[model samples]
Target: MMVNDKSIVWILKIYLLIIFVFIFMPIITSVVFSFNSDRFPSLPLGHFTWNWYDKVYYDSETWDAIRTSIIVALSASVLATIIGFCTAYTDFRYSFRFKNAYLALALLPPTIPLIILALAMLAWFSKLGISGQIWALIIAHTVLGAPFAMAIIRLRLQQMDKDLESAAWNLGASEWATMRHVIIPFALPSIISALCLTMAVSFDEFAIAWFVSGLNKSVPVVILEILQGNVDPQINAIGSFVFATTMTLVVIAQLFLFTKKPNNH
Candidate 1:
């Protein structure tokens, strides 16, 4: 039985390794090709060089897209996190009629098809006379990212002790005081995690941005433009940078999420 278990463990490890390789091989290839001196990716990679990276760095259009993406991501993530915290707190603190329906609506955006969501946002923003503006992209991204933030914060809130708030109230704390002193501190890690995760989501998003971002293009939109024009080596370099940035944010969020102290109660 011991030998069988060891063999099974080895099999699982190998399977997991294979899965990771399948998922990451394309990204690894893009990173490797970004450093290659060759204009086109092929079997025999050209000499290792920084030419592609330099070109992407010096391109004004690339910088503009990156700046726009940063602004939109930062704005959207803040809005999303704020909205998420409020909705999560409501769910955590109260019970009302059609509460399940409220939760369903709160979490529904992410489940909808991105293209459909994008089209709907475009129509709505156009009616509001905000389409094709930076604010439009910000609003659309906020909508897309809010559900993710809510899910993350809600999970963390679920782990909290229900009686902590009651104890605070009993000790002469007002409702707002209990929230400020106890709940926020307890969920701070997850809140930060949600912020990072939502920022990453907004940074990487393309479809909605493409629809609403008339002149103000984000990084992903720029990438698509590059692809549409030609097979440029600069794309590999830019993709590598975007992937690195997004992965960093995801890693930071995951670290905060999983490193929280377990609830004793």
Candidate 2:
């Protein structure tokens, strides 16, 4: 039995490694080709060159997309995190009818198909006369990102002691005061994690942005436009930059999540 278990463990490790490689190989290829002097990706990569990166740096359209993505990401992440915190705190501190239904709706956006969600957002924004605007993309991304923020913060809240808030109230602290001094402090790490995660989500999202962002394009939308034309080496460079950025944010979020210390309160 011990030998069998060891063999199984080894098999699982190999399987996991393969899965990671499969998922990341294309991204790795894109990064590698971004630095290759050759326009076409092939064996025996040409001499390393920074030309593609330089081109991406100077491309006005690319800069515009990057700036739009940054603005949308920042705005959406802040809005999403605020909404997520409120939803999570309500779930934690309140007991009301239809609570489960509320949670289901809160967490539903990510489960819906992106194309369907995009179409819905476009139509809704059009009705509101906000279609084809940067705000439209920002609003759409906020909706898409809020659920993720909620999930992360909710997990942190679940680990908190129920008596903590009660103890604060039993003292002289008002509801707002207790929340500010106790709950927010305890959940601060998770809040930061949620912000980073939601920003990453908004930064990488494409379909909805493409639908609602008629004139103001995000990075992913721009990538799609480039792809529609021809095989541009700039695509590889842009993809590499995006991959790096999202990965960095995700890594930071994970670190905060895992390294969060238990509140002494």
Candidate 3:
């Protein structure tokens, strides 16, 4: 028994170590390379400097792309979360024929080949005379983000106590009031989580963005263009900084919202 327990512990430790290293190795490598004094993104030994980050600061195209990316991500995330909430709430509260089919269709794009979806969107936008613009990208991203938001919020709603909302309705509250006061507050954490996740997905998304972004370049496209032209270490600097900043914000939000407080039970 003792030997088996020890063996299991060793396996678990090894598994965790492997996972951690696998996840962080690339990030560590990027950070190290970003500081290398060489203009080229390369390795072993070089004097470290902040010039790459400084270069990033002065790049107008990079800043423009960053601004564009933020706008697109925020718009897509908010729109998607709202639509998903409405869809999920309706599905949970009502019964109808083909309800499952509707959900399946909404979720199909995320699982399908990104290029195929992009092409379909491209065709649709061209038909609508709205091809190749930031609006197109926002539309595409919202469509993709909606499924995830729906899944997240639906899970939370499923676990929620329906009696709370029912009680409010029983006391002569309107449907809107019950939901606004009861359901929304109870589900706030999950809603925030879903919204944040959608934002992250839209912010970092590359393939679909590459397709639907049209003439207005987002950060990922701009980064790709810059790297393709020159083996610039500054690209590495920008990437490392973005990755670190994103992770930090995610961690802070999670801790702020999800941490359990003493005496809550």
Model 2 clash number: 0
Is candidate 1 or 2 superior in lDDT?
2
Please, what are the lDDT tens digits per residue for candidate 1 over residues 133-212?
99999999999999899999999999999999999999999999998999998888889899999999999999999999
**Candidate 2 accuracy as lDDT:** 0.95
TM-score, per-candidate, Cα-based:
0.96, 0.96, 0.91
In order, candidate lDDTs are 0.94, 0.95, 0.81
TM-score of model number 2 = 0.96
Against the true structure, what is every candidate's RMSD?
2.1, 1.7, 2.4
lDDT by residue (165-254, candidate 2, tens digit) is 999999989999999999999999999999999999999999999999999999999999999998888999999999999999999899
lDDT of 2 at 73: 99
Query: Best-fitting candidate, measured by lDDT?
Result: 2
How would you order the candidates by lDDT, starting with the best?
2, 1, 3
How far off is residue 13 in model 1, in Å?
1.6
